[model samples]
Target chain A: MAHFTKATSVHDWLDQRLAIDTLRRVLAKEYWIPKNINFLWAMGMVLAFTFGILLVSGIFLLMYYQPNVNLAFDSVNYTIMREVEFGWLWRHVHAVAASVVFLIIYIHMLTGIYYGSYKKGREMIWISGMLLFVAFSAEAFSGYMLPWGQMSYWAGMVITNLFSLGSLEFNGLVEWIRGDYVPGQAFLDRFFMLHVLLIPLAILALIGLHFGALRIPHVNNQDGEEIDFEEEAAKYKAGRKRESKVIAFANDFLSKDMFVVSIFLLFFFYLVFWHYGFAMDPINFDPADGLKTPPHIYPEWYFLWSYEILRPFPKDPGLIAFGFAQVIFFLLPFLDKSPNAVPASRRGIFFWWFWALVIDMIVLTAMGKLPPQGIYSTIGLVAAVAFIGLWIALPFITKMEKKV
Target chain B: MKELKILAIVVFFTLVTYWLVEPFAHSQMHKHVESEGFTYKDLPALTKKGDAARGQELVMGAGACVGCHSIEAAGMPAAMDPVTNSASYGVNPPDLSNVGALYDAKFLAALIKNPAHALKVEHKFTPESGKMHPMPGFYGAGGDIDQEVADMVAYLQSIAPKVDEITPAQAFETACGRCHAVRYEKWTQIGEKPSFKKKRDELVFETKLEDYKANLTNYMGKLPPDLSMYIRSRGEHYLSTFMENPQNLLPGTAMPRVGVNAEGAEKVIEYLEDAGDPKRAERDSVGVKVMIYLLVFAAAAYLWKKEIWKDLH
Candidate 1:
């Protein structure tokens, strides 16, 4: 039997019914964050902020955006841009946010890897974050089709065609996904729904799951030091805050997060206003025409690294390597084979492995954008092979670490 | 020190990525066509000045300019209706109200003497192709042909609006609108509204459109693409160079050099940008304010963070 508080005012009445105070304590006030964490930890919050911007801007755009293939191009280029007041601002912000969100995700994921944040107890956090990444990728791909421009049509065509499964001949599945022989009215309509509704709901749920998974293990630190959260939190509550290794997440950690977030917004809006061209491919200015194809077709920059992996090989092998790159990141925790959970710098040969992977990814991304002719083709092939080789070498290299 | 090192690494990687993805890749993809000798030159008629009054008489009389073109700003109307002109010439002869403001003086003189040579479309309009240029060259049509060419250019320069006063939309109308339609601007090659009300008028509009497209295909070997999105598809540099000499980038292209001077080209580019990316100015201005607000918020947040962490350290 629980004793209920006397309902004096609205707050007291709500508190008694909802356990609002306890909920806040559990979720925010008493949630412990390691004090040794750096600004990199704030990327999660930045991603959330970007998603909020996307949702608001997307809703406003949806007011004028026609999902019909014929009208989508004009609605975006003319009605939204020329007729509606500040429609361009919403568009620029949405485009910049879509691209920048991927940058932050990559940083967040890399930070987690750098500090071994996925080790043992925090696997759910990583898995949930990866799920969010996939959700975001899907959301972006679907949103890209809403414009019905050349790149939008062709990219949709190429990506859907990938469903054929090489020699297995699963082209029927491709038609099923597109709802037609080619990307047309049916393709645009379904993608519009996925972009605006389905994927966004999934992303929101995954975000909640990701944050919820973080509560148990708290968060990894810059130094990867494992502090006793219960003891440090107790010490802080008892007024020995200076001696504690953890801090209350409500105000103290939030202030730090806000600081990083503000700085990020400063950079983000700069891109939105002045440097938005990168977000919008110039080739996409042309309206979709099925009869003509662009000379060179490529995915957005965020997907270029994996796209390069797929491009350098024959159809079957390329598909296999592409699949490998996509699934390999999720298997990092299992493949690492090291007992120690510390920063790469302290893990000996893992440092070399980490930098090599990072540089190799950069190379692959650069190669993806280039025309695969002569030297570029050779470079792309080597990088793809090296990427696969590095993952195979991860277990062997990390296993040799003497539990530092 | 550690933070500085990390920042340096991030910046270095960002630069490398940007360089490789944008500038370096662009260079490899679209090799720059040299602009040497592309400008129309060697028209000595332009060097010698003439009387605007005499020029106006030659233009109205011997030049037969009003037979096709309408210098609307100068109160000179076309002899034929726009629809009839499209049927006769395969495209509407553009209103030359802004020709003096848009084209180079030498190019104008050359255009009067030889339309194919001035437009750099001689390759397509060759005798072997059996396609005659609609506008016959006035090279030896009458007495004092050089003086006639010079006088006509002078008269055009006299009646035209000042270069600065002409809007980008007007420049595009005179320069490219005869062949290319910007559907987003509700502009068509015939400069006529697509009728949606009366059945007869709608039929007339449809026939005119079909005739214009068919004639354009027969004349140029293909119908020209709409200019609504060309500014985006082909970037500014590519468009500028391509306009300077179409054959340099796309060999054997039917597109003729319109002989627009540098200032005129700028206006045309501005119009394209307006159509393709209308939000650029708003985005840039609002971006500044947002950045300022963010800077202030970041400063305050940083101070609050410093204050909160002070006791912990």
Candidate 2:
């Protein structure tokens, strides 16, 4: 309304009635973004692209996938792979997209944390991102069961059984989740609904909230100081010759984001084609056997950190700790209430603690893949302790640190 | 210029994604070609109905089932040369009273055809090591072998306990209680030897159950494993495959093959599943209803989120 464009005949009829031009300018064209953001920030767009690929490919896969316990694995491996046109491509794309989504999101989250993107007004944004992560995990887990392979069956059994450690009553909850004493047809059917329909809808809604929350404030920059978008807008209007600190969302940042996403696509497609089954466990090729249990029962790489947190404790307590580890990230924005919002490179002393936690996570991930015995168990305990300790120490340490 | 670059990137991304389809199709074809398993879906279906009575006769007579294994329902007493059998085979043959409840028909047929093949035994079993492969292929290209196997499997099914509401005691009896007596001391006085009565109609009377329990050690060369917890010790899958042919799971084992059909083997599996986890059915039924509740909750939550976020957007 403020800067109305002259009605061009092609879009004029729609533009006057629907304010299409205004919507475009507000949503895409003139939207303000910090100019200083590096390629690390591009991971957010990369994750969005990955989600798009998953949703489209998943829809294709859903057409052929049989949710029944008896036919699920065969449908994916035999019928869909051989009978359906381009079905193998869709399945691989969905599977490969899942791993890539996690990869991008992890980098995105670390970048957010390293740059203090969760500070002050961005609390809701950070929390919603964490919730998205939780939903994505649930989505991934439910999707994994669609194949009804040996690993999926046993993993479902092991994970659901974790809920039984509380009491006799809690054991009922475990059975309810599993739909049987173990994973079976009922479990597969329920998970199918969750994977294809329910969780994806929830994820879409959360992504909307994530973007909405992001729009309220100027994008956080490498310098950590928030840019004044109002001043930039005023300067642009006054015809100042100086270059704007804020970049236009449409042609500038969008192009850069898409360019990075394209580069990421090259890698993602490479993994899908050349190394299609790299992240997949070969044992999962076999159909679900309630009788034959695979010796090693480790989770996918992304979940290894949280899984490692449980190894040191006994069953009931270990499960409790694992649950806490997942929920603990939500409390991070409040815990580290640092007045300074400077990037990690400039944030003296705190950078070491941050990197230590990062390194600790890497170690925990490795330990998670290893059998929970001997030196690995010891390392799991030590790392878990250190992981929690960093959060506890964060608020106190940040408050005491000198301003940049 | 920027728009053209973006278009070029988009085109490149699309090309890269589709490029791998050919390779993916190749691997998928490879998977189909190489796949091999003794799954129930892959086995040939039986045209004729199995005869339990005929099966009983073949199991006791031609099958020579009683030479090694014991079935509680048949009152079949333990093998005569327990020591010699154990010395030659390494362990005593497992009792087949619950074999019906432990394995399915396909596994049983595969085992009866070739014990070594059924067990997935990788060891080179030759004619010289005939002693090592204790359970010979009974259906070795013989005419009427299929019918004989079907009858024997039916007979095993008849003797083996049917899968029902398996109480702890019944579960123990079927899966482990036969071999591993729960409390041997409670059943008999110290120094009292158990006895068995052989009769015309009964090999061992149903009344002298305690007597059979007392003589278990004499019949079994080595102490049998405690059955009270065998279901827990060996998982359901391992038990199914192992029951098909113990030699495959454990090489040089004295456990002789118990010839059963696929249905008989499945009955045993059902019994074991029931024995270890009796509440599976009840739990599964409740799960569907809970999911329905979750669906409603998810719908309500979606509406609520829409209402809350409407103004913000």
Candidate 3:
């Protein structure tokens, strides 16, 4: 409705029509980030960069990937790896990115928790980030099916069978989800669609919501100091940057992010080239056989903690615990009742709680990969119970903390 | 100090997880099997050296190796085509061209005297089952049994090409192609199919295919799994050990101990990697370049970050 200026150049023309300049200023140029944050703060950018790599490499894979169960295995191992030039590079990139992205997400989430970044006003950022995590998990699970390997078929069977609701006899729900009695053509087709298109769309939307949510509250910092972003940003804009506790997100914060990302990429490509065997499970090299199961069946490393939670209990209880692990993370903002937004190191019992939770998760993840026999079973049960106990104790412990 | 502590915690957890998942869990699953008798040290014939010329004569005459297998590289052909051999034996007899270069010498001698004993598959071929190995054991046609086996071994070894010269494909064919088909390589268990001259020949071909499968299933307990992806699935170490002694992994496995020596096993594994994971070479080479590029980029990025942050207080 307002008068539009005459176009002077390409960007100016778009700015007049689409408010491009305003969008840029709002999104990047004027966006204030805390200066006290460490390299861990760059993990979100790393995750986003990894997602971009996944999208590009996945598209290349999709060009040759067959969704039919009959051809999926051959298409991936033979056609892509053998016939297509540099096909292996794209595959290693996609596989490694799919795996490494989870590692970065965990770091980002832990950094959030350690600094109480999910407190009060920053709840939406944490919630949206959690949603992105869920979307990514779905994407990874579906993408795993595209290979149609032994682990793919069995892991899909195990996970989808969970939807049968134990004693509830809701198997129809699982069949509906799989689109078949077993993971066959129908299942592969639907999963392929989800992996390539549907879940990625959901992830892109969630990523937008996550970034948008960060805009309102700004970012939390290491010392959990209550930063006056408005004041600091003004000082930064007025060239009094030395005393300012904030920096513009454009070149200043981005430079730091790029530095971290380059290092992350070094680690990532190292895996892609020499150590990609871990990402591509040895069992998965065998094409999916409905009759033959591998000696050991487990989900990828990222899901191992929750999987261990499910395994250490009886059917219904295990399902309940598994569900608890999945949903409890979303409730973190409401669960921690501390008034302080300080890092865990200064937060009395929560410091121990933070370390205990990290160690418990590591144990659970390790236990998940192990065969549930002898000592591993006992250790797994303890870790799983401890995980639930930790969450239940979080609110009580935080409520007892004195306001900083 | 806090960051260092965090890094230490991360590294410690990573190593712990790796140990638990890979090594410790693997040990729990596959308790190491003692391969004490796999070398055939108990067989006196294999322990002694023999004359290569006598060995060649035994193979060409009394040993009857050419009855089922074609030592084509050594200028000998089987009595029957692959299809015919597969129909009769339930699996195509592999060409013996690379066997000398691929199999352990003791294993070859033991296999010749007693196929079931060498493979540790005597349990499957027990007299009660009324089942026996397709190849009849040679006892020494009016000669010393040990001397005859020793001569045959020497002959086979003499005819064998240098171990390094044997390609991975040749190694795989000699070691595994009889039972396992690598469809990616267009290599089938029965080798080449015979062309049908008439409608009855087509039916006969189908019958032969069915007979071959049935025979393999009866002999091996089940049809051997395709080796197309086994290199990726079972891995190099598992495959090597399994080849050395199948019963070590699966106690009742129908797979006979092929007795592939260390070098032979390496070649077979190399071939499997080629068929299953052809991109490995490219991945390694490209990975190194990518690592170098990323290192340079990271160094530049670090410098840029330092420069930008120098303006900050």
Candidate 4:
């Protein structure tokens, strides 16, 4: 087998600035993505596609969207309703699609968690993914206030009011994000700037870092039910030249990827035509009105499970500190004690994992549907115990099962 | 034996999935409050099994119901109908001949009093952003004879429809059609704006017509549900009383207490009281569904036949 070649710029040989063909060839040949990857593996592609869509569309939107309350809303309405032939439709679709994409990301994250995609060498990939998720949420919040509508203004007011509570200690950035003491037109303008400008660029950087870390070792599906590829590759190292020849990425997986793409388009178009879309309000047409809060003030559905968790916290709403609780939860990969992922042979561990996730989800969404109350504390405590059980008990169960 | 084992497992799982999903699907109606829920009896129906032959003549004649509702099952909208090309795109007014196949009386009731409301307002769940017929806003602030709305409702309910209605049949075939033509004519005219009562000079027509229009419209200030099958879709006959004097129905209802003179109100009531027809087609070949299914199945069969038949030869 060829020894690892030094990173080469082929400018001298090709007399060209970039060697696109060589890069393509290397990727199409040597990339060692897991051959046994299932649907969860697809989520990376989905996230990549979503990020691209957000970037391209967001740039065009920023060009026309006015974030100052003076013209922010009406300008959006003008751009969408009257100026661009189908601009209104696109604007609404993008806003609503952001909600959907994040929900999808949340599901993708859960799939990773449950399948133990974060164990061992996969830790960087998981941590990078979590960072991307956090950045994505930050992007969503900043983007939401750009429209500066009654809904956006009130939601901003509710979120930013907590910034000054002595400990979380964002003395300026929170105010900077708001642009004023309270959410209004100034806040809206600067938010639009950050949402369209700052966060998107940072998101791109984080995505690169994520993929960079992911490629270091790929995911640690160490004990999943599938064949382990790195192990399989080690066995064939002596024969890898021939083996790689036999199973070039294009030949082995490209056709399968194409088939999956075909099935995806079939269902996607079926829903696009049949259901058209799940319609929602276009918020930018109306300026922010602080006096009123929409009766149904749930966060985007991606956060429903977390919102459910927050609902059950026994402390008073103000005392229970937002974002901190979640940042702690994000450190779950480190907290996990198992040396590697739970093996499929340890069915009891996964079963418990599945139930904990499912119950937490149900209880959280149920909490979202209700007014926050004290009784929910009991429910949250129960859910927390279950979460702790999976985090601690399941690892032990897996270890004992292996020993047995 | 191995294949049989796989098939058995597939069947077992299919049964489980169906059970889990069924309660969430069409059963949502039963899950909601029964007082204002959908029922089969809330649809259009004919009491007496009259000859479809006689029913055809009335439909074709002064009832001129076909003037608005075009049921292609009978024939495509007459190419030469008076209101041809009236809409920017032709309004293929909801077909009623086999509407029994399409919807129940409650839906029909909502559609009749207000056709625009039925399409755009009630079924707002559809993502068809534009391309809606504005027909429901026909009620005038004054001078609309609500009797015409009642008669139209009665006659529509009177058809020998697949869907059975709780209303009576004689009114549609006989009395309901007399003034109903004017109603559909009014609906046809209120094209883009989609309101009936907004027509100029609506007040000069009558006094009680004014009051009845006023009260009902006020209570339903925001886009109200369609009114075609008001009796059934409303889940009450109380709406008619509101038409007589709407204040009785809901305290703040702006609906006028008009056009329900004792005779007209009784006649309208008598018309809305029959329920029985069972010959509706539940499934037929729609162009989209049939074309896709045909394409998929035919391709599969042809491929299989080619592969296996060559070997057989």
lDDT for predicted candidate 2 compared with the true structure: 0.66
Q: How far out, in Å, is residue A116 in model 3?
A: 0.4
User: What tens-digit string does per-residue lDDT give for candidate 1 at A102-175?
Assistant: 88888889888888999969998999999998999999999988899999999999999989978888989999
| Model 3 lDDT, full chain set | 0.85
Ranking by DockQ: 1, 3, 4, 2
Residue B100, candidate 3: Cα error in Å is 3.0
| C-alpha DockQ of every model | 0.73, 0.02, 0.71, 0.03
Q: Per-residue lDDT for B1-313 in model 4, tens only? A: 6435633643453344333223332133222323222232333443333334443554455435565556555664644332332232232233455344323334444455555443223333225645343343334223332433344444544553432331233223222321122121122122212343654544333332333334333323532322222333232345444443333444443232232223334444444322110101111123256447645744554455444323222
lDDT of all predictions:
0.86, 0.66, 0.85, 0.48
lDDT per residue (tens digit) for residues B1-313 in model 3: 7666866776676677767666776677666765443354554446567788988878888448877778887787777866567667756777777788778787788888887787787887799989877887877767887788888888888888999999887787778877887877776666535566899987876676667767777657788888888887887777877887777788888887778777888888888888787777777788788888889999999998888888886
lDDT for residue A45 in candidate 2, whole number 0-100: 83
Native contact recovery (fnat) for each candidate is 0.80, 0.00, 0.81, 0.00
iRMSD computed for candidate 3? 1.4
lDDT of 4 by residue, A1-404 (tens): 43334455555444233555677666664455554454445556656655665666676676687767776655564454346554544454456557556645765676676667776677778777888888888888887776666557776876675565435566586777677767766777667767877887888888888878866665544245444556655543455433321233443444444433333334333432332223222232235667656544545445545555544543454235334446645666666555556543355565566556555655554445444446655665566445444555644555554321
Superposed model 1: Cα runs more than 4 Å off: A1-6, B33-45, B73-75, B141-144, B192-207
Clash number for each model: 0, 20, 2, 47
**lDDT winner between candidates 1 and 3:** 1
Model 1 lDDT on a 0 to 1 scale: 0.86
**Lowest summed lDDT window (length 10), candidate 4 chain B:** B275-284
Question: How far off is residue A199 in model 4, in Å?
Answer: 1.3
Candidate maximizing lDDT: 1
- Looking at model 2 chain A, report the run of 10 residues with the lowest lDDT sum: A235-244
